[model samples]
Target: MAILITGGAGYLGSHTAVRLLEKENDVIVMDNFTRSSAEQINRITAAAGRAPEVEDGDVKTKEDLERVFQKYNVEAVIHFAGLKAAGESVEKPLLYYRENLQMTLCLLEIMEDYQVKKLIFSSSAAVYGNCESMPVSESTPKNPINPYGHSKAMIEQMLEDIAQADPAWQITALRYFNPVGAHPSIAVGENPAGTPANLMPILLEAAAGERDAVDVYGTDYDTKDGTGIRDYIHVMDLADGHIAAAASQKHGFHVYNLGTGRGTTVLELINMVERVSGKHIAWEAKARRPGDPAENWADASRAERELGWKASCTLEEMCLHAWKWKEEMHKNTQKGE
Candidate 1:
């Protein structure tokens, strides 16, 4: 009767857990705490008014996953556990493949063993590689140029094959665009490990004086401002999409693109963040990151029509929410001293 969330201590997973709790679904959080923190668990408990059933275990381990399934009468799973650094995936392709692909395989096997059929996977837009058009649809050719993207693509394929073999399996792979921002209360937000590989987190760090300056990757791209353009969706919106997909009466393997259906360039995002935070963001243009796309937005009609979900927040709202979270984190750190 509980929905199990892998890596529930993470940013998006934690936000999704909050939403699930809001809907009155009992949540069982499974995490190894490798790249996450216990502070997130505390925050989710505070926001949701109840602590989720926490299971400290790795998804890659069969015993670990099985134990969790046995302990909690898990009805479904929202998988968010995996390595996500695009650049690092290129260098450590084997590690990426082993962690991402192997973990999914292990989890699926356990799900089968436990007879839990419903699964909602957290996929990325990186699976699309360099899209031919601006607004990418679900039918776009999946020619992933990076190991990270390839890993996600492989998982999608695996899910399809699994569903085809068994008719009872209900799988939904949500291909997410760039997810930014935080919960409105500033109770929880992204906490990246080491230097963040994503633009939004890096920009926020620069604004908070945690970093020297933000590096604008590839300013020569053929975009509105000669910078890369990406569809930025709020973390909360992405979380809502996952909940909708999980509760759907529909069956079989399906994929949905989650985005705002509009593109924002790197420069525009930087300006918006600065304006929202009232902080000067020092930035420098850098060479293009390999496997980077010139522009990528989602044709989110499927999510709108099928799931009855559409992003309602604006770019300014996303930036303002993220700034508030960052500012609160700073004040909390100072107060603790």
Candidate 2:
């Protein structure tokens, strides 16, 4: 039996693919090279020391999904195929809803047809938009404020309904916090095709002199140091959480927050990057972005108790690894790698 990773060329998907490959599982990567590239599959191979069979296709197309299901003995799926920028989703709500929802619906239909019920969804902490508490739990009322978060919450509800109706399906939705850093190999990291929407990448850009300065969004959000606080877990740890969810013996649908229980402020993140990269990162305070919360961490005890998974990397290690990856990418670019 093989595991089919939709969007396996993406940042989170590629890291998860590497982890799965290291475990000696047959991994078939299906991607259309939209936000990622075919060369990412090669990097996955270099990182894991094993190659995954690549299928060039989009998840929105049923024919493409059906072909993969027919071609492989796909026993499980780790779904990471979706547009993930909250700001972009805000600007293009219709596109986000159509593409994100359509792709999942198509993938689910194909899974049902193939009788392959095991799935691990790539969810996000954005679903817990502006929670009333610190350290949001699985039971927190999913009151998503943005179109992107709404898409994720909608999919989680859909999965719950499907699992409730059928006892044969095993689905787990992992609500990830900010997944920063990269794999230790530095071969596979978060390198988006166009502009990056995440924090770490933008910070690295400013540190590398690729940009003028990092925009400190919302410096008066009632957080310590007057900046927003978030749970920034390393990308590798997030990848391992998917592996644990796949290995879980539990039946029925479930949701787990893949994050460190601690929170870090935006200012602290900037300082850490500067300290690690040995460069001064200039920043300018800006007005708060709409729908951004003051504090958002995770209550990850359930994942530990149920899936035997917990984040192990520290913030310092996260910054160090990400800096190393950025430096390596620069050298490769200069050397024409």
Give the distance in Å from residue 284's predicted Cα in candidate 1 to where it truly belongs.
1.4
In candidate 2, what are the lDDT values of residues 71-107, reduced to their tens digit? 9999999999999989899999999999899999999
Q: Any idea what lDDT model 1 has?
A: 0.92
List the global CA lDDT of all models.
0.92, 0.92
For candidate 2, what is the TM-score?
Answer: 0.98
The C-alpha local distance difference test score for the whole of candidate 2 amounts to: 0.92
Q: Which portions of model 1 show Cα errors greater than 4 Å?
A: 335-337
TM-scores of all models? Answer: 0.97, 0.98
Which stretches of model 2 miss by more than 4 angstroms? none
Worst 10 residues of 1 by lDDT: 328-337
